[model samples]
Target: MKLPVWKEGLAYPQPSEMSYPGGMTRILAHDGRRDLLPFLHDCTITSHEGRLYLGWYNSTDAEICGSSLIRGRYSEDGGESWSEVFNVVGEIGSAEEHFVPASFFVHEGKLYSLITEMGGKNLSISLDLFQAPETSLDEWERVSVLSGGFLSNSSPIPMDTGDYIAGVWMPLKGDTPAFPAVLISQGADIAKPWRCSFLYDPLAPDAVKIRCPEITLIVQGSAVTAYVRNDEGKHGDLTCGPSFVFTSEDYGESWSKPARMTAMPVGNSKMFAGILSDGRRYLIYNNDQGYFKRGLLCMALSEPGEVEYTKVYKLFEDKAAELDNRVGVWFYPCACEQEGILYIACTLQEPDGVRSAVIARIPVDTI
Candidate 1:
């Protein structure tokens, strides 16, 4: 499908007020500078019961001057009238170096967000889990921290038992390629002996592997599918990118043989995905290998087997080429599909220089 030149809507509203060296600043930090740190990447927009639910990172120093983590945002009038950014995974201290926000969803009358805390090596104990509040968009609070590990880009799939199945990658000690790990848990007890298992173990006696996985649960159909990349070193830096998939039938029990997705190979990282209300699946990713830059965002649809699938289509691509150097490249795509309308949100290098969030609304048929 031919991609559309992003039909820009009202840009995400800037924080009403901020504190700075001179005085209080009321500007959207879209310019790259020491004063602001871009943090609105990896965004998801879900329209439920007439309201829009947005979740993304809130770079700590975006305004006052520090590093921020992922947070939640909401819009009452479609994409207009955005509420002030609220914490989805709570706030981090200045001493904390690696706290990043990712993954968002609405299940069982609550907003679920997964935020990862990376502390380099010593901080190997990364935290990735779900945060739900009464009304998180307005008054965000960390209801619970699901699981912690070296998890960065992950996708949470809800199961029939009110629990969750998530796709994760925990780096194994040394230079071993990050292994794809699966976690099954209920509520917020990640420490309860995770119904966990490592899907793709490169060093294992088994030759097959699944890397960088993104999973979706077809609750009604009782099926689960995971998309992953086969980064088996042999691909080298060229094939070191992403384009792999794995599927599961028995909840989180076992996975089928992985099928290579040739559709999303230009150069991308994390694969953020979602399932439409009608049961169609959507996968959002970026071509971030830097060859064409991270300007392209692609969406693909498919069933369980991976053989029969919709032709990969570029849903949204970064047109802000001139501002690439200042704001960096476009990446971190999070998506939400409801009632046939698919919402794709991502971060981009604004012409002013700072990194800000931009969104695109597309019909599922367009994919």
Candidate 2:
């Protein structure tokens, strides 16, 4: 299969222009000091009980070296306006801790936030349940730590048999490098032990260098298809490579060997794939040639079990020539579908070195 070619202004369901009162596109949060590098990366948005919640990791001084914090904002009027940023987790300016928000999911009538804490070279992943105080969204408590893994931004999927499965990438004890895997839980209960199954081996002699694995799963009847991002292209080329696929027939208990998806050309970055309520499968990713030059953020459509995609939508294009060698444009988009809108939260970078967390409310009917 050949890689799908994306043309400009070819998006379906034509994207609406910025026409809201305060503007459809607004910066959710940013660093106060212009000298510091403010980074808001890999945000997750969820609509629960008639309210919208956006969560992401914020770093003012540096991207990964300094202290990072998990912050959140809420909008009562469907994202038209958001409240002040509230500390979701982490101690502000902690010298020894760097907290990063991973994902969000609601189970058993409670909202849960997943966070990854990085200290030194070790990474600890945990979950906290949000406790709404009487009528305030500012107050939230960290209940307990779930499993200790690495960074996972994919939402957990509830199976028909009542189990839940989530994708994660972490290194095992004594392993040289980490790789992508899945966590199977008995139900929505995070307190219970989760069975861990590594989808691919990182230390295998022939294994490629995999980083920041974003695993997206689509369930069709009894089969579950996983589309995983290969951050580092196979061999020495890192600019452009095919995403990998793993299919499971036994409810994720077993998976087929990883196979290259020649139809999908993904840069060494995060990509999202999920089946929406309208039965259309959508994939949002950077359509660039490879290796961190993420300028064109696009959305592609396909059937449930099909590998080829069409109806390509160019969401945003970064025009900063200075960012050519650096991480370009939009990256790390965490998306969810609500009502008729597909809400995506991602890190948008400007030419002046200002990075922010921006939200795009895309209508699904247009596609």
Give TM per candidate. 0.71, 0.82
**Residue lDDT tens for model 1, 1-367:** 1111111231211112211112111112222243244545556556656666776665554422255555656766545456666655545565355455566656656656566665543244555445455543443454454565645454466677666777666654565655666777754444343456555556866645434333333333345656553444443244454456666667757766555554445344556666666555556666434433455666555543332344355544444323342334556666666555566666665556566665556665544
Worst 10 residues of 2 by lDDT: 17-26
Structure candidate 2, residue pairs in collision:
13-366, 239-290, 239-291
Instruction: Tell me the number of clashing residue pairs for each predicted model.
Output: 13, 3
Top candidate, metric lDDT: 2
Query: After superposition on all CA atoms, what RMSD does each candidate show versus the true structure?
Result: 10.1, 5.8
Q: After superposition, how far is residue 240 of candidate 2 from its true place, in Å?
A: 4.1
Model 2, range 307-353, lDDT digits (tens) per residue? 44655666566542222333338878778777777787777776666
lDDT of candidates 1 onward, in order: 0.52, 0.65
